[model samples]
Target: MVEKKFTIESSQGLHARPASVLVNHVTNFEGDVMVHYNGQSINLKSIMGIMGLAISQGAEIKVTAEGEKEEEIMESLEDVLKEQELVKN
Candidate 1:
């Protein structure tokens, strides 16, 4: 498993578009992925799960991946955060 902590960069936080990008990235990975905010954790691939997370600006999220493609998924997840997510890790 791999984990990376990233701080939210977008003032509006994830909202809709950025969350979709995150969800889409998670869905593409075959391994298990979980995104943790504060002390709660949710499935990264679920749209509702992500929206329910309601991440806010300056919030810290822990991106984790486990299973066969853990490393790849971790990298992919990081890329999404850096490129699409309103945050940096």
Candidate 2:
């Protein structure tokens, strides 16, 4: 299992565009990937699940992955977050 925390830094927060990008990115991985925020956890590959959270700027979120490629998945997710400018430096 691998886990990492990040603070949302995008002015628009984790809105539709970034949320779609995130979901699309994780869908390629084999295993379970989840995002936790505001005491709730949801599958990272579900666009509705992520957007439903209404995660705004400054919200701290925890991402976790478990399975054979957990580490790689986490690294990929971190890169996506940074590339999208959705996480703080």
Candidate 3:
């Protein structure tokens, strides 16, 4: 498993658009990805699960990937987060 922690930077937090971007990106990978926030963990591929978290700006989140191409998935996710301007610099 590969895990990384990030602080959200978006003013609107992990709202629908960003959540969908994340879910859509990870869906292409053949691995398991999960997001942990506020002591709860949810599948990163599930838009509803992410939305249910109601993550706000500056919230700390931990993402974990396991199985095939876990490391690559982590790197890709980091890239996506950065590209989306969702994480602090």
Candidate 3 C-alpha lDDT tens digits along 26-74: 9999989999999999999999999999999999999999987999999
lDDT tens readout by residue for model 2, 1-89: 99999999998999999899999999999999999999999999899999999999999999999989999999989999999999855
Task: Please provide, for model 1 over 1-53, each residue's C-alpha lDDT reduced to its tens digit, 9 standing for 90 to 100.
Answer: 89988888899987889888888777876878998886788888888988888
Query: What are the Cα lDDT values of the candidates?
Result: 0.83, 0.94, 0.94
Q: Clashing residue pairs, candidate 1? A: none
How do the candidates rank by TM-score, highest first?
A: 2, 3, 1
Model 1 residue 69 lDDT score: 82
Q: Supply the global lDDT for candidate 1.
A: 0.83
TM-score of 2: 0.97
C-alpha TM-score for every candidate: 0.90, 0.97, 0.96
* Candidate 1 wrong stretches, greater than 4 Å: none
Please list all clashing residue pairs in model 3, or write none if there are none. none
lDDT of 2: 0.94
